[model samples]
Target: MVGLLGWLISFFVLIALLVLVVYQLMCLADLEFDHINPYDSATRINQVIIPEYVTQGGLFLIFFLTGHWLLALLCVPYLYYNIKTYMDNRHFVDVTEIFNNLNWEKKKRLFKIGYLVATLFLSLFWLIWSSVEDDELGF
Candidate 1:
């Protein structure tokens, strides 16, 4: 029962990570028009995302096969950071208008700090969770 639960958790986490990577790719495409230009379409954005996704998938596979709950948990923050970075770069509003509407520097700083703090907390959780033994689960 425990092994089945662990597999399900890891599988769902892997799916979530894949979704985030796909979203990141869409954001990258939105930010960099050159990636879509017919004349310059050879750019390796898709190639890059694929390799990254594969690497993450490999990690999940190893964790699932080995029943390494900690290793699987560690992937959470790593995926979060990648998604956050993509979101930070892919602002939807016009930059000039956004800047004019508010203190752009302050907003940028706050956002940076927020993401940094979030990433740190997530990493810490992953580390702590990874240390927990499988049988330690409370009945």
Candidate 2:
């Protein structure tokens, strides 16, 4: 029962992360066409960034401590990149600086999209493993 609950939470958290990354991608694409002002685009992307990391960091702790060791390990590389970019002061966009960093920002978010896709796959694997374990245990 507990294992099922943990797997569900992890799965949904991954889904939520996926949504945020996709939104960021859309905002970046819109900015390319001037459909949205740079300030608005940067602000929107910036707003989602922190919450995404916080959720991911929390997910990491939950996964690492709750016996989802493989998933937990998979979270580390991206989380480390998050921390590194943050410490280097390169993650956020300033309204004045947005144009200068637009290309780099897109590259960064693209990498995140790739990471999220991979994470979703591992999460699905986790679900499959959990389902099989539950069946064996008669849960």
Candidate 3:
């Protein structure tokens, strides 16, 4: 059982994660950040922005707080996806026509698929871990 202090901390972290998600949504909608210089192609804000890190990290924290170690292991694959997405977007400015024409929509779909796979893996691992733990305890 998590203490009151832990619950409060988790709640605050969840709120912060929600705020970041909203900010990312605003960026995606192109309804803000009009002041950024278009000529400065070097600083691609979108390329540096991978919002899943926050969401997935928040979920991992929640799982850890709930003592779901096996489920929390999903963070590994989530981090991998985040790094891959960032790298794909960062080098997207390459002069090669192939790199320049990278499809962001497809990348997003792939990330979503990765997240889903991680979720499935987490569920399966958690189930097996719990069953093994139960057997060890003579359940």
Report lDDT (CA) for all predictions.
0.47, 0.85, 0.49
Worst 10 residues of 1 by lDDT: 38-47
Candidate that would win on lDDT: 2
For model 3, name the residue pairs that clash: none
Residue-level lDDT tens digits of model 1 in 1-139? 4554554554554444445444444433443544344222223333444455455556546564766665657656655654665567642333334324234423443553454354345444544464454436643
Error of 2 at 73 (Å): 1.6
Query: What local lDDT score does residue 13 receive in model 2, on the 0 to 100 scale?
Result: 90
Model 2, range 1-139, lDDT digits (tens) per residue? 7877888888899899889888988898898888999889989989998888888898898798788888789899988988887899877778787778778888887898888888888888878888899999888
Count of backbone clashes, every candidate in sequence: 0, 0, 0
Error of 1 at 30 (Å): 6.0
| Best of the candidates, TM-score | 2
Cα displacement (angstroms), candidate 2, residue 106, comes to 1.4
TM-score of candidate 3 to 2 decimals = 0.40
